[model samples]
Target: MLRIHFTDADLASTRMARAPDALWEVAASLHRFQTRAGRWAYAGWYRTTHARLREQRLDRIVREVLLPLFPRARYFPDFLTPDQSSCADEGLDAALDAIVSTPSGRVGRELALLHGYVRVPAWVRRLTGRQERRDLVAAIRSYHEVAVRPFADQIHARLEAGRSSSCRELLDGGVQGMLAGLGPGMRWQHPVLQVRYPVDRDLHLGGRGIRLVPSYFCWGSPVSLADPGLPPVLIYPLLHEPIAAAPASPLTALLGRTRTTVLRVAASGAGATTGEIARAVGISPSSVSKHTGVLRGAGLLISSRHGGNVLHTLTPAGASMLRTDT
Candidate 1:
């Protein structure tokens, strides 16, 4: 378990990431390749990513180079997932630049830590070399283009939904409620936030605060930087609803005013709960449920239960249809 001790000041300063952290997503996505623990949730991505890697001829590089460096084990180099504050924005280019510019000493030290956990190839030491770092960055960019970028719309939609949920929690119950609502793996006890983790450790945030990053690829327990001295960040998985296998109805079939309003609500930055949707559309909650059922059947919305309420967000197909209609 990871216990994050927070001072009153830390609580005041804590904030959620407005966008996905590009490098952290890369690390977490690489981890997906290492385990089948949550394979059902990522089955579509797994199959397509495998084919993409083979088609791009990056299969060997990923297996021999990336996997060894980022084993889903106790430690990996922190330098690889640079603090987003150092980048101009959360774009992959900015992140790649940060990785390329990582100080050689820091890279060497972190790699040494990784070496202790898994066999580090002698050539991996060359990452400290400027040209080699650039080469590695190039490879990482290619991998992202093929494996991660294709799902950008889905990722953005999920992050937006998550942020909306967190914002509501914050408004209704303040930071404590937001923290407590951070899915099943985390518990917000006063003065400290306890997280299920692979190892036991304590992090005392001395008023530097922490950034709560919601990641699409991250699964199971949340991840934190190994070195606590760095700016504190907690990267946690976004809740993924299982994709329904029902055949989708055409967009033309979903043009009713009420259904259109429902689609818009799901697309909104502040995603709607079933009760909220019923209120918005001036319909009964049971009527709203039937509407959401049709939307889910058409692959236009995904509903997941949070606490006692069910939250709805647009699937990529749903968002696309909303966009085309508008």
Candidate 2:
């Protein structure tokens, strides 16, 4: 179990990443290749990514350089997923720059720690040299471009939906409520947030707070930095459901134009409230509610009540329909 000790100030400062962390996504996507545990959840992604890697002739690099460095073990070097990479504005290029500029001494220390858990290739020792680190970064960028970038839209949609749900949770019950609803593997027990982990540990966030990063590729247990002193972060898996292969023709056809517009508005960023949908669709609030109720009944949308307002977001089935329609 990993117990994260939080203070009152820590709770006050807690926040969620506005967008997916690119480097963390790279690490988590690599993890997907290493295991078959949640293969069904990512079957479509797995098939496409695998084919793309082979087609791009990047499979060798993934197998030789990337896989060894990012093993699905207890630890991987913290330098690989830098704190700067978590910024919403800074993207893959900035993240790669951070990896290349990481202090050699810190890199060496983390590499040594990785060696403690698993055998690292002798070539991995060459990472101490600036040129070698640059080479590694180049390979990482290639791997991400081929394997991770192609699925950017799906990833963004899933993240937006999750962020909407989280925001509603925060408004409805504050940070603690948001924490409680993070995932099944996590439990919020007052000062400490207990998480099911491979090894037992405790992280004390002394008012620095922690960033809750929702990852599309991360599965099973939540991941955190090995060292306790780094700006705290917890990358947890998003719930994955198989998207339907067929288009949602019947549902959309039955709803006609206004209801269809409401569904589209609800599918927009972070979801929409009844008022937001009404304004966007130019319909009355009662009409918006009637439309959403029918969609919700069909499992096309999910509505959560937050005091007087209700937030509505698309289910996976609904998202699939939008994808097909577009």
Candidate 3:
């Protein structure tokens, strides 16, 4: 179990990431490649990435460098994922910088840990060299382009949904409610929030607060930075049902062009207000309202009154449809 002790100031300062942390996604998604854990939830992505790596001739780099560094069983270096990142490229740069600037002592420690159980590849020794560090960065960039970017839209949609739910929880019940409702095994009990961690640990926030990051790829349990003194951050898996893809032609046939466009616009996670839909789909508000109404009737959207305006969001069915269209 992991107990995260929070102060009053910590509660007040807690906030969610505005967008997905790119490095974190890369780190967490590696589990899919290592095991069959999230196979059902990410079968499509796994199959696609598996083929892409082979097609792009990145199999060796992935197997030799990435797989060992991002093993499923034990700790990898925390520097591989920065505590926070503003954008994907920035995060990638930060991760690569961490690799390049790693002290030989830390590299030796991490290698000893990995080598304790798993078979350490001979080439991993190059990690401490400057030229080899650049090669590692190139491998990461190529792997991400092949393995992650293809499913970027679906990943973004998942993050946006999680963010919306978290924001709503924060608004309705404050930090306590939001914390309590994080996931199945998470419990917020007064000064400390408990998680069903794989190992026993305790984290004292020490009034520094913590950043709550919702991850599209993190599975089973929430993860935190290994170093206790780093700017505190907790990455929890998004409670997303695996959206099943279906034939888009049927929906297109049923709704026709403009209404189908509206459905897709809503599913794009671009702030699903009628006006936002209007602006996004290049249609008037009246037309957006009319189309959203039909979609709501068809069980593709759910609309709620938000003060004077109505917010229309995609239903699970609608999200499934969009995911299928991809």
Candidate 4:
């Protein structure tokens, strides 16, 4: 377990990132390609992403160069994901610069860990070389464009949804409540936020508050920068639909206005309870329960009991049925 020791000052300064970090998504998406864990959640996007990569002949290069460097293992280089930037290209530029300028000692150590999992290319050995740097940058940019860019709309929607929900957590419960509700494998007990980490570790945040970054691609448990000395930030997964959603024609046609609104409310990824949905749609709990039962029966939503309340979220089909306004 990873223990994040927080001071009172840290609580005051905790903040959520307004947007997704591009370079981090690139890394996380690569991790997704190697697994079947969350396949059901991102099925639609996964099928198309693979086909596009293979068609462009980018899959081989990505597998050879990028995947090895950013493996789903313990020690991906921190420089590959820079602090948030206004644009993906801007973030990529900064991250690439960091890679090229990384100290040889740190590069060797990190790469040694990476090499343990996969063979490192000869070009990767010469980190500071201009030609090698250019090659690496081009490879990352190509992969991002081909495999990741097509789902930009879905990514943005998930980021926005996560930010909105996080804001409500902050308002309703303050920093401790917000942290506790981050996701599974996380708990907040006063001064320390505990996580079920892959490796046991601890973070002593004396005063510098941690940045809570919501990621569309981060899966399983929340991930933190390996080096504790760096500025503290936690990258957590967001509940997202696999593909870009179209307007719910079939659902709307089948269910009428009120029930459709109820499904749409569940699809918001907020895990709202019955009462919350009723309040949002101006209906009563009994009415909300009726709508939810029908939706769940149709496999459009799933409700889980959380203490006295039940929280609802969309299933794969449910997410596909809903429309996102880009």
Per-model TM-score, in order, reads: 0.78, 0.80, 0.79, 0.75
Q: What is the C-alpha lDDT of each candidate?
A: 0.84, 0.86, 0.76, 0.77
lDDT string for model 4 (1-326, tens) is: 88999999999888887766778888889999888989877787688988998999988887888887888877777767756432445666677666667676776776666667666677676754556767887888888887677777657656766765776787899888789788777889989999888889999988999988888888888888887887888888886443322355565566777777777667665756786576656678998998899989999899999688887888887777665323
Best by lDDT: 2
Where does candidate 2 stray beyond 4 Å? 245-326
Question: Which candidate do you rate higher for TM-score, 2 or 3?
Answer: 2
Residues forming the 10-long window of minimal summed lDDT in candidate 4: 240-249
Q: Name the best candidate (by TM-score).
A: 2
Per-residue C-alpha lDDT of model 1 across residues 101-138, encoded as one tens digit per residue:
99999999999888888887899999998899899988
Stretches off by above 4 angstroms in model 3 are: 84-89, 245-291, 297-300, 304-310, 313-326
Cα RMSD for candidates in order = 8.7, 6.7, 5.3, 8.8
Go through the candidates in order and give the clash count of each: 0, 0, 0, 0
Candidate 1 regions exceeding 4 Å error are: 85-90, 246-326
Q: Model 3: per-residue lDDT, tens digit, 25-132?
A: 888888778888767878877888888889989988888789888877646666567653535456666666766777777776667766775787888776767777
Residue-level lDDT of model 2, residues 1-326, one tens digit each, is 99999999999999999888999999999999999999998898899989999999999999999999999999999999988887777677788888889999998999999999999899998898889989999999999888778777667766766787788789898999999988779999998999999999989999999999999899999999998989999999987654432244564566676767777767755687787676655678899889899999988899999798898989999888777763
